[model samples]
Target: MSESLKNKTVRGVGWSFVDNIASSGVTFLVGLVLARLLTPAEYGIMAMIAIFIAVSNSIVDSGFSNALIRKVRVERVDYNTVFYFNLAVSVLLYVLLFLASPSISVFFKEPELVKVTRVIGSVLVINALAIIPRTVFVRDVNFKTQTKVSLISSVSSGAVGIVMALSGMGVWSLVGQQLSRQSLNSLFLWVYCKWKPSLEFSIESFRELFGFGSKLLLSGLLSTVYQNVYYIIIGRFYSSSLLGQYTRAEQFNMIFSSNLTSVVQRVSYPVLSSIQEDPKRLREAYRKVIKTTMLITFACMLGLAAVAKPLIVILIGEKWLPSVYFLQIICFSGMLYPLHAINLNILQVKGRSDLFLKLEVIKRIIAIAPILIGVFYGIEYMLWGSVFTAFISYFLNSHYSARLIDYPTMDQMKDILPTFFISSIVAFFMWCVSLFDISAYILLPMQLSLGILLAFIIYEKLRLPEYLEVRQLVCSLLHRKNKLDNKQIWTKN
Candidate 1:
């Protein structure tokens, strides 16, 4: 890859940091408001609707975004073809979702889900429309426009949701917010980009894109099925309250996990696609990406688990105390989420979609059946099943990463072992601190401060390249300010 490409990737990631903060802030406010406005049953129904929407979303775009970005020579005709194709599939998906609404409601024994499913089903189509235009923004590395698009969408949705919540619209508020965001954002994206599609279809171009799309489609399908199966199983077997509890916990876990992955994956995939021919540089880039992703993901997840009670108590309410355990388990399950995105991108860039799809399919087959069986025994067993699935899935994900780098599975583990080990040891000590006869207010902050201090100290002691980079950044800013002042003084003289 050219140095300019690397610089562009760096700039993209830097700009995306602002997008992340905007998204995080809006989501936090909306989640807090909605959690109070809606009940567990409401969220449970929304979760089922969310599952359908999410799974459908993964399939709707035909992975055209990735396919377009990966290929060296993209055409207006091809882009238009993908756009029209995705629009067609998205319409079909909406119809299918609407048709499935009654059955889905019956499947869960929640008749009210019919309306909810149909309402959120519209978003599938809206999101599909957004894909081509949104990808256009990212293709040329114009994250500034992308950031504005995202911020406007998020803030507007949050405003609409708050109003709906006040008017007793409940779940519809969230549904409307999502649909509005997609609709408005797609409109904006179309206006921002110069590219517009013609009503043209090419069989050859379709095959080229679909060949990649099929693998991503399958991988996405399995991953989606694997994820929703958890909620489906829980909802089918347990009460709405329990399912809602799991859903809330999972939602919060994903808010962090998805945001982390999105921030990095958005930058990583395009960059990887550009660097597809060079293995060594790609591997090095992959390593740094994984390192930083793990450092952040592991810390966020474990830290949340460590302070689960306080967070839930402060954020939700006392009624959600049962969810604390589920939240903790989901946190651990999500620990590998952010870092694994790079591996997925590597597979996408290498055009190994078939292998990627097969890997996840095999994983779900091997992983899900046992969990399904375990749940039949009891809820406690089900919880254990979740914990078991997470560890095994992490290993499976790493298997793909290992194949890419010609590194051993354990060596892959070795890459993240330091953070894992340090986080575990620190969490254990903090747990010890929690055992003391003091209020959580005291112990929580104490452990939070001390544990962070210890982690930073250990990280500093290791003196990773990132540590030196940070130090240099601070020094450079100070030196630049001095230079500016000196230049001004010299001009005055």
Candidate 2:
């Protein structure tokens, strides 16, 4: 990689890391308070409407934001076209969802979801408005602005959610949180991003983008639907309270998996895309990203799994104990999510949305049987099925990456397996520690510290390239910070 691109990638990762930590931390805290305040049934109501909001947002985006990012030369017409298209789709989808909310409520046997769905679905419109501007930031590798936007949105929205929960708003508090975040995110993006759409909308530009993006649109819609299918099944077949427990468990898992994966994938895609034409460099860069992502995310997921019990009991109380096992099981699946994401990103980087869609179809097909079988058995069965699917999905996601740049599934696995094995061993040790009859407050911290310390010690002893690279990256960042501080002091003097 060029030094400029390398530096951009590092800076992008830095901002993304800070953004995710701050945003996820605030959301995690707010969720803890809300879990204490609201019942599982209330959270289940929010979970019930989650699919509608997710699917609507996906349709509104229609993969155009990615198309914009992937395009080497973006025209003003492309921006205007995507902007208008997203706006129209968002409005139409929201209206459709509004009208269909009653049917959804009926399907889930939850009468309260009718209004909740409509209120939360409004976020699609707010989200749609910000797509163009956000795409600009991402395409430019300008994550600093994105970080500020996320921090502001997360903090403000979390505060609103907490206040509303305290004021007895129940599920509406969750809805308010969603709305506030999206509204603020859009508002901030507009204020920060100077780009604006003109009255012009070009059919040619639309077709150009759509030609590449339509497959992604289908793939995204399918992926979104598949991801949320469990919620639908649980909500429909089981009790709302049960679904709420599952949702809470998934949320805890996601606080680590999703945020960390977002940080790596967001930085990896644009940086990798910048070097797509050079197979040698692309392969090398891709491997490094995979190793680094695996190292960090593996440790996180496994460590969180080991500490799930004590952490859940201490943070959210005993009422959420049922979610502990669920969280643990899901974290196993979450460990490979960054791998899945970054592999898929390689396809996008190589402009193979067709292969991307094809892979999605195949994986989703493979996923269906496991999910169906699990549903017949039980929730735990379904979760174990998810673990099965996650492993399978990794190979499927990496198949094209191998063919494209010779970074095959087995090669990628070999690169990541050491980190995975070491982390797993450390996590098991942590779990053993947790078995002691100690206070959850004490046990949680102990497990975290020991797991982290052991993982670091093992990595250092192994002299793993990825671990050393990460250490160097941190040291370089600190060095640069000190130099900048010294220069600022001199200037002030």
Question: Candidate 2 on 310-411: residue-level lDDT in tens?
Answer: 888988889888888889999999888888898899889888999999988988998898678756888898889989989888877888778989977888
After superposing candidate 1, which stretches have Cα over 4 Å from the reference?
Answer: 1-3, 436-444, 466-493
Query: TM-score for every candidate vs. truth?
Result: 0.90, 0.97
lDDT of 1 by residue, 293-326 (tens): 6766777778777877766777777777778888
Q: Top model by lDDT, which number?
A: 2
Which residue window of length 10 is worst by lDDT in model 1?
465-474
Per-model CA lDDT versus the true structure: 0.77, 0.88
Error of 1 at 351 (Å): 1.2
